[model samples]
Target: MNDSEDGRVQQLCSHDEEHLITSGTRYSIKGFRFEPPYVLKRAAGHLCRGHVPVVLQLFFLTLSAVLLLAVLIKGQAGMADGETPFLVTVSSIANTQGQEQAKKEKVYKEMSQLKPQINHLCRPCRWDWTLFQGNCYYFSKFQQNWHDSVTACREVGAQLVVIKSDEEQSFLQQMSKEKGYAWMGLSDLKHENMWHWLDGSHLLFSFMKYWNKGEPNNAGEEDCAEFRDDGWNDAPCAVEKYWICKKSAMSCTKN
Candidate 1:
């Protein structure tokens, strides 16, 4: 308890306190300051343990939202620029193809409708001509002499009708029933008493020589043959009478 002892003990205590405060200290450099290594380490440990994972999750979520927004904006801009989307373009092309196919089918159907129908059971003949079996006949409406009648038929690319059967004879007999007389293809003008067709062809069948009772008597120098409702008869070549013309079925096919 002397005064010197007391003062020395007090100075030692003060020095020890100052040394403790200054030891491991941080210093300010210009406008920046640094923490001691131990303090910085404690702060980093708190951030890693408590808040770093939450901050990372928030950053990722924000980035994902920004990316989605950008995609939506691009799609809208493409639509506004009049650019067709992939699905829309495909649909439009398909529609155009369908229309073209429909047009082609319609044209084909029209052509089919317009085409002529031909079959074995039925045949066509020219207008104003009658079809029977395999031949077509044109019954004239005006009267002409035998030679002039043959010329008239030849002018139309046909020949004077030749009666080949009793059926044809009956048909002709019925056709000129109203007029009562029609010049036939039979003629003896080339050689008297020898009957022949307009083209100088002889009659092939003996049964075809049907005559009315006692006719072809060569009366009045009758050289041409004409028919009435009953049967054939010889007459003058200059006597005018309605005639008949004939053509094959093949020649009338265009009808």
Candidate 2:
């Protein structure tokens, strides 16, 4: 019970006053009951004869109780709101973006399950504008020299197609009605022997390579390329053949 004679409540006791914790959170003190919830209150009661201000004591104690209740109520409300679709964050502490995200994902999945609207789209490729499984598809029909084929693909607001996965490659190959040859988005003219798609994507991810015979020898005569039924082959780029095109995902939308 040692404090300044002037009477300023710095610490509360009494064993109990409302104490703020390390979390900047307020809690009701137990095991000790002092007139005020501050160490200074106990000091004044025991050490000082009277100079303590009763009004100040009541004000501080009541304020602490109110603040503690608010914190508890807010915490509980925040938890409840987190389970909802949208979260409104007052401060960083009550932020529940992760929970909200989960809720959105759950809702999205449930809605998707109901069934998709009937699709009316055109499929070209080596790209699948279709939504089958989790991948897309596209297939080319016109047989053009590798270069012309690429130009044709670009003309229709699409680019030469690149295979992102094995399933796509197999799908395109299957869709190739000619069973002869078709241009794909892959070449090494700019950098010999180092093949890459028109998008500058590397050939590291090719799953099923359909090179026709012992070719791509950079025969020098055939600079562009094509993916035949079950392999790859070198072909002239300027040749008048069918070509593949990849429309932008935004434009790929089925009308």
Best by lDDT: 1
- For model 1 the local lDDT of residue 254 reads 34
lDDT of 1: 0.71
Candidate 1 per-residue lDDT, tens place, 148-183, comes to: 999998898888988777798788888878665898
Clashes of 2: 28
Model 1 scores a TM of 0.50
- Deviation from native of the Cα of residue 171 in model 2, angstroms: 0.8
